[model samples]
Target: MVNGFMGRVLRAVGMAVRAVHVGGIMAGYALLFGAAEARRLLGPRRAGHGARAGGLHDGDRWVKMLTRLGPSYIKIGQLVSTRRDLLPPAVTGPLSRLTDAAPPPSRRRVRQAVLAAYAGTRWPFREFTWEPVACGSIATVHEAVTLDGRRVAVKVRRPGIQWVMERDFALTLAMMRALGAVPKLRKMPFKVMHEQVGSAILRQLDFPAEAAALAELRTNLAGLGNVRIPEPLADLCTPEVVVMEYIIGLRRFAPGDLDAGTRRQVVQAVLAAVYEMLFIDGVVHCDLHPGNLYFDERAGLVMLDAGFVIRLPDEVRRSFADFFIHMAMGDGWTCAQIVIESAAHVADDCDVAGFRAGLTELVQEASGAKSGQFALAPFAGRLFDLQRRFGLFPAPEFAFPLLSLLVIEGMIKDFDSAVDFQAEAVPVLRRRNMLRDRTAQLHK
Candidate 1:
């Protein structure tokens, strides 16, 4: 039919437009890389522990470009900001400020997603706010009230987000392939990083998972009287929408806004809660940065954004706990041993002795640092790099907790410089070990 022929023509035209749009963004990134190469050739060289001579200028530009490119790229930029191993401080430091808040979806789209999520099931919301309370890369959250008068937060996915994400990921992988061809970049785990992060972003698209994670966290963290997680309304949640009981906060706390005592309490509460998540519960809220964490004056530190959760197997969790405990205690040999045992693949040609030496030296350097001066992010990043050099590829589960640690370390440092991380974590580590021992004995 003539109509079918016209439809085919329209489809082709639409494909062409999308290709051009994506191609234009790719071209922008290419130009940025070209500038980086030019800087390497012509600019003054800088050197230091984490010195990146040419990358400093590119970081802000990358941020701008990612922002303009839309949600998927913005999400990647936020993730890459935390990846100190893949990028230098000059780049990651600036990119760390990249906010996840994006423009909100139209009210019409919100209504459609909400109706679909609650289709044929006694509509839960008595009143749904038209304007969004929060708009992030994955979804926009609106304030709503249940039929029974419970205040809730309804997170609605942006229309066509998944399709856009898929398109952008394909483009990103293609670009990675092109970049990986360069000899200097060949050894870097671009594919692993891409696959890991891309998969995480995709997984986050599942709102049901987020809802489940929130419920699991609430149950697991019940003992932590001060810490809070938003309560999920299980029956109302769907893949595109998560409806959770909302907690009212007087305000999100800034580090300097609180007194020293309050700050110390907040930091300790966070450390204890997060330690439980990693060592005991075996599930972690992978994104625990400042923006995702809030202080409810009455309810303690409130953790948000449960989309990027990671679950570790029992063995992996035990090894991770042992590794951190040893690292905190300055036992680099034990830490290195744990890492070797935990790695996914160790090359035949790996120099075991050399790895041990490097690890020992690295740990010594870090543990010897003065209080408030030690940086765990860079330390963990260097450890990752060392593992790569030894041809040891760690499991994705192993890397995520380290990234969480990096985020937590930064948050704690901002709150209380005087708080001794090792001393504070030691008690929790001991408690975890004690529980493990008790469990082992019970099984025997």
Candidate 2:
């Protein structure tokens, strides 16, 4: 009993320390950004230029602070980087460059995790590199050759990552609760948002689940001839370690390096695969950041990392498909109605007519815009801002599907600026009978 009490007390002390550290960094940056903004507004012309430089400096400092805070904050930065609507370009631009790379844990730690994962079984690797080829917030991956001479990537979870993440999540929730006490913030579904994000982060620790997701995605996306998913070696996978095919490709590729034909093919395959996942399969991979995707001339679009996958219910899938189809067709009224229907919460004082009008305008503006003309980042930002304005809190099911698309938009635009992102989804929408039903419903 005494030991249990002591453990609780220690955990409390640790969280308190963590809170102060996190709060200090955030507060310091906030003040720095505020001062820069003030200078930009009220100072002389030279001071305005200095303020602009200061903003850029603050953005870099923000990235550094998040990295120093460890995995949870790094992941949070990546997520916030997607919200171009919530923050200015100065902040989001620097954040978009925040990769998940971290210094590898000790070799002893990696070996211990590997041994524990393979307990009671023969060590299967013929050759294994002690140095990690890639290290990220959750795991470090080493190149290995199996006993049968097959090359693979051995991904081992960081030591005590679960405990560390849990502690950070607790502190984050406590902070959110404190924020929730403010009347203006109380309307936002902070608890639900935290639960959704927290659960997804925790889920990444389950290597077995990730392995299964990879297998399922491989099977589901096999029909997309040019898209590839790394096949997880099921026999070798465990909660702590996952061995998969070692894909050889470049995560950063110059578009000009690829022939136009290859680039178009690659872009088409990626869009088709993503649309299939969102509309047809209802099984979506939420993390498609640059690090998790690769391009190979031979292998085509190589998608990696299935650690953050979400399966939408059939109803939600259909609703979202309907929403997208209407949005494409410029049926803004229907889009607005779908938004209301699919929202997780409708505020008691929600401006229903105002929301519908605002969303209608947003959709109408987006309709028929090609990738070059239509930027999903800013559009999503506007959409989210509108939702917040009208007190229509988005369901996680709805939000994640949108995030899956948002994460890939930049890559797609980079690959083929002329591609009509909305129009490209028509064939898939038709395949799912969504387009036909929508037409009939509208005509009736």
- The most accurate candidate by TM-score is 2
Clashes of 2: 0
Q: Write the per-residue lDDT of candidate 2 for residues 210-295, one digit (tens) a residue.
A: 99999999998888777778889999888899899998754553366777787787777778889999998888998887667777
Per-candidate TM-score against the hidden true structure: 0.83, 0.87
Q: Could you give candidate 1's per-residue lDDT for residues 242-343 as a string of tens digits?
A: 888888863554576688888888888988888888888888998875457887868387888798898888898999888878877788998889988887
lDDT of 1 at 237: 83
Which stretch of 10 consecutive residues in model 1 shows the poorest summed lDDT?
47-56
Error of 2 at 193 (Å): 1.6
Candidate 2: stretches off by over 4 Å: 1-7, 27-54, 57-60, 79-100, 249-256, 297-299, 368-371, 434-444
Query: Candidate 2: lDDT of 96?
Result: 63
Error of 1 at 45 (Å): 19
Stretches of candidate 1 above 4 Å error? 1-23, 29-63, 79-100, 175-193
